[model samples]
Target: MPNAVEPPSASPTRLEEAYALLADASGAPWRPLAGGTDLMVQMTGGIGEPPERVLDIWAVNELRGIGVDADAIVIGALTTYTELRRSPVVAEFVPALVEAAATIGAAQIQNRGTLGGNVVNASPAGDTLPVLLALGAEMVLGSAHGERTVHADDFWPSYRTTARRDDELLVRVRIPLALGRQVRFRKIGTRRAQAISKVVMAIAWHSSADDGPWADVRLALGSVAATTVRARTTEAAIEGKRPTRQTADAAVEALTAELEPIDDVRSTADYRRLVAGRVLHRLIRDEGGW
Candidate 1:
């Protein structure tokens, strides 16, 4: 007779109960499940073994809302892309995030995919990642021990990995308000819609004057590196320089030198590098009215 398969164990818990479960160190690890957008796909596709214990946090209401404080906009981890796209707070402050959220999958995927899941998944092609990097977002992680915050720049250290500990949950994200900054987001993919990104870029900057040096420039890109990376070299090339054809050229040069994309099924390294430079040039030229 064939050995009977043990069914997976799942526990639905509230926010406090979830924390308690995570705090207990002796038991088998419980995999946290929110929207399960990516996890379900992976599980059904046989990409990995199913978790023996699943911690269902969908009912953890404490992790589901958008609010604003004096210095930053707070977005709960479980907030869905649909909610992000429709959020008036997001629209007014970080419109690039709204644009990114709209590009995720279809409406159904957007409705079910949570922001925390996207960040935790740490996919280099994730749409919102570049935007978060450009905006200098901070993640609030919570566990039974306590809550601590980490900058988005320090969150993802490698491809498909994040700094989140096994015992902690990403509770919320805080985006510092940039009231007068110019922001832009662009995503290039194999198809016009509902496709994974080939190259994605987001940039934020404050102009010193109407047509002069740019300051506080934050340029970030995805699908061109192991992790979504801040294009610091490219940003340095543009910094304190007026938006011009020459500046754009220098930026392209620096960007080309900095990126080390891989030849993957979605795109080739050469093509991704070329597109990233082209996008940077266009962004600089558009901002300069050239």
Candidate 2:
């Protein structure tokens, strides 16, 4: 009997081989498969039409680890949440990413879900999206032609859509380093774990002191609109300001104007807005010590 732990039958083991398979018209269209945490679920639930052919990239050794460059931490696309949560590089350089990874589904899902898959899935409520936005991460896409980079903010152009072409594969994610940066992450879900997030927020800022002037502020929130969006207006409103009730209020008001949340089964529009404001206020107060 075939070992149940092995990947699907007839999967390619090399990246170039997989790309070549995808380029072949004989298969018509081929979808790359890594962890299959999301795709398999969708296929099983009949959520969408299944692909004609699959290029299983699970055995592609090239896209399966985390490393560091001169000024950035690079994570392979197929690096699972479980791998990220335990990686020393992630823990030292991007703890927010680690925190985000830890909250995604449960242990099984974490072990089976790839970081690249999460980004490509393009769910507005994806736990790591907001963190990536705040950290100013970039996606490295590869194909038979060459490689291209896309900023996190620009990758998702619409609801459940991305700029990635069918022939391109997201090979890795790159996050630049920022010292003395404080990161805060929150996910409001029906349950603590194993539930899709209703609202996810990530805030990163550099401050010389706990309650002093701040700089390089970046705030991103998910499950609010068509995609995970940065609260630029709100960030500008409180940037460089000393922690205070007035700044908190201004931040909340600015966020209220920026977000365009909709009512869904998980949450109401009004509730989401109100909770977002509260969360922002709390984040500023707690982190800023106001």
What C-alpha lDDT values do all the predictions have? 0.89, 0.87
Ten contiguous residues minimizing lDDT sum, candidate 1: 1-10
Q: Candidate 1's residue-wise lDDT over 1-290, tens digit each?
A: 22234335555457778888877788777778889898777666665666656677888889999989999999999999999999999999889999999999888999999999999889999899999999899999999888999999999998788999988899999999866787899999977668999999999898757678888889999999999999999999998899999999999999999999999999999999999999999988988998
Give per-model TM-scores.
Answer: 0.95, 0.94
Deviation from truth (RMSD, Å), model 1: 2.5
- The residue-by-residue lDDT of candidate 2 on 1-290, one tens digit each, is 22223223347778887777666666457777789998777766666656556677888888988999988999999999999999999998888889899999999999999999999999999999999999889999998888899999899999889889888889999998877887889988899789998889999889887788778889999999989999999999989897688889999999998888999999998889989999999988886565
Best by lDDT: 1
TM-score between candidate 2 and the true structure: 0.94
* Candidate 1 wrongly placed segments (more than 4 Å): 1-13
